[model samples]
Target: MARIIGGLTTSHVPSIGKAIAQKEQESPYWKPFFDAFKPAHEWLAREKPDVAVVIYNDHGLNNFLDKMPTFAIGAAAEYHNADEGWGIPVLKPFRGHPKLSWHIIESLVADEFDITMCQEVLVDHAFTLPMALMYPGNIDWPVATVPVMLNSVQHPLPTARRCYKLGQAIGRAIDSFPEDIKVVLLGTGGLSHQLDGKRAGFINKPFDLWCMDKMRNDPEALARLSNHEIVEKAGSQGVELMTWIAMRAAMTGRVKELHATYHVPISNTGGAVMLFENNPQPHAIAAE
Candidate 1:
């Protein structure tokens, strides 16, 4: 049986990755962040889980105005890294694990999570930024990943409660996997910051830490927090934090803090990364 080994929450800002890769972590705004990620880098390598269920919102890349599925999972055998802006040098096709991808999708559908499964999806920074920022190119990402997309960039997104329920479903599905595997459920986005409109360049560190505390200690209240409230306090784009609630809900009480860090450099947003060990111990190697 598969068990969720732990969870990680990180900001997907492209500049965050660029800052680390360029070795310019000395930037007052960015230095604090690079230092914080060291622990996560060490921990993830130590717990070489078989699969990482990545929860992220696409920036009008895969799912656009043409049609957006509130929740989409990559079931494709391969995906391409088509950089959709902010300094992505180039893109290479990302190979997928169809066997596991399809298995999870089918399980989610059976569980009534209602997800959009992609056979051939192109991922932008939403997926790649995590690779560059947290995992970095230097580390080998051996685990298979499942990309879960939420509609945050556009309106008509799923409600906070709804996303939370979906996370629960993911947990159930992973546990149901017949083979022995360790899963890493990652919810990436937010820390109270906005990136557009008249109220751009907002950073609410107090609220960010509050949300993290509530997420770890009292999730019910956090889950109940309204989308409008998240936007008002976290910033307009910060509504994306709804996805984090889902990840928290799935993990429930099975969580342990490994590392935590938050920082706001440029205007219009704040970036943060917190890592946890879902269980006491996980393998340094996993067979997907």
Candidate 2:
């Protein structure tokens, strides 16, 4: 059966894309954040997962405020990157695993989660930047991908608990697939930072660190938090952390923290990169 090999998390701030385009990774302001990915790169080299299920939020690129699904999955043969007006150069399309995507979508629906199925989807920076960070300079990505997007941009968003459950469902789905493939989960976006409103440019390091710790040691507590509480503590945009929570849930096995690093003020956001290994085992869900 297919199994999860590991999981990854990172900040997908638009400026990070621009930094790569400008070759500014080693620059003073970006060096620390860029350096964090080295260990992740090494881990990727060692494991070489066959597919990546990227969990991210669309920033008005594919889904807009007027109409957005609470959750969406890409089932296309190829996923493309577009000019989202962030001045980040467009990237070549990433190959997709249509078979796996369809299996996941069917499983999710059977598991009773409403899901948007997209045969053709445009991947924004949230999806692309994280891929670039992991597989730097590989214009042609090495592994097939499945984009799992959450609606963090709109209100009435899925609660932390709901997102965690969604991840659990995804994990179960992948585990049942007949293919003997290795999968990696990528949860992109947020450590903490708010843009717009009076609290624009707001970031809470203490809360960010606490969330990261809980992600490794006590994700159940983190999932218990309400959307209002997360926004209040993490800032409005900080709700992006839901993607990370979902990724963690998908591990569904013995999880070990391989490496993690956090840096602040990356394009007015807290930037973080984390890698975790998922050793196969019996499926288990944390108790509420």
Candidate 3:
């Protein structure tokens, strides 16, 4: 059976990556934030899981307004970063795992978990930024990837409960994998900040801190949080935490945080970097 090796929590704000790619993530406010990611990066290189099941939202890049599935997975052989009006100029194609991905899809579906499977999808910065930030010099990723896209950027998105259930389903699917492997469920997107209306650029430190605390200790309470509540209390448009619910649920009410960092470099936005380990059964350690 596959084991939940570790997890990562991050924000995939496009501007953040744009700043870094342009070599500008070292400002007085942002420098300290970037510095905090070292341990998370080091942890990835050290653990080197067989696959990283990424939970991220697409900004209408691949899954357009035409048909948006609340949850989707890429069972493709590879993924390329398409120019979303703004060019990356130097990024290469992203790696993917077709066989394992197909297995996940088949398993999830067999267990009555509905998921949209994609063959052609161009990942936006939401998928690329975290990888670039975490593995900057990576030419070829040491492990494969399973892209789980959520429809949080669009209106009428999935509820926090819906996302949480999906996470549980993913965990069940991973457990049924015949091969022995390590899986990392990475959740990417916002802590607290608004990006729309006159209230744009709003930052709430208190909410961000509370979010980090709940993410580590009381995830169920965190899952109970609503998008509107997050927007009104935190910001107007950056409450993408639903995707993290799925990541959190995959752990099945068990996690030990490895690293946690929070920063608000850009005005009207907050960013965070966190790491978690999922050891479902404490005694399972001795068996390994």
Top model number, TM-score? 2
Clash pairs (backbone) in predicted model 1 = 6-278, 79-94, 201-268
lDDT of 1 by residue, 252-274 (tens): 33577777877675334677777
TM-score of 1: 0.90
The Cα error of candidate 3 at residue 263, in Å, is 0.9
The digit string of per-residue lDDT tens for model 2 on 1-288 reads 788999899999999888998999999999999999999888888888999999999998899877789999999999999889758899789999999999999999999998999988999999999999999985568899999999998799899999999999999999888898999999999989899799999999999999999888988887899999999999999999999999999888889999999888899898888899998764333221
What ranges in model 2 sit over 4 Å off?
282-288
Task: Evaluate all candidate structures by whole-model CA lDDT and list the values in order.
Answer: 0.75, 0.92, 0.79
The model with the greater lDDT, 1 or 2, is 2
Rank the candidate models, highest TM-score first: 2, 3, 1
List candidate 3 segments past 4 Å from native. 283-288
lDDT tens digits, residue span 57-115, model 3: 89877877888887899988888887777665445777788877888899888877788
For every model shown, the clashing-pair count is 3, 0, 2
lDDT of 2: 0.92
TM-score of each: 0.90, 0.97, 0.92
What's the lDDT of the predicted structure labeled candidate 1?
A: 0.75
Give the winner by TM-score: 2 or 3.
Answer: 2
lDDT of 2 at 144: 100
Runs with alpha carbons beyond 4 Å of true place in candidate 1: 91-93, 280-288
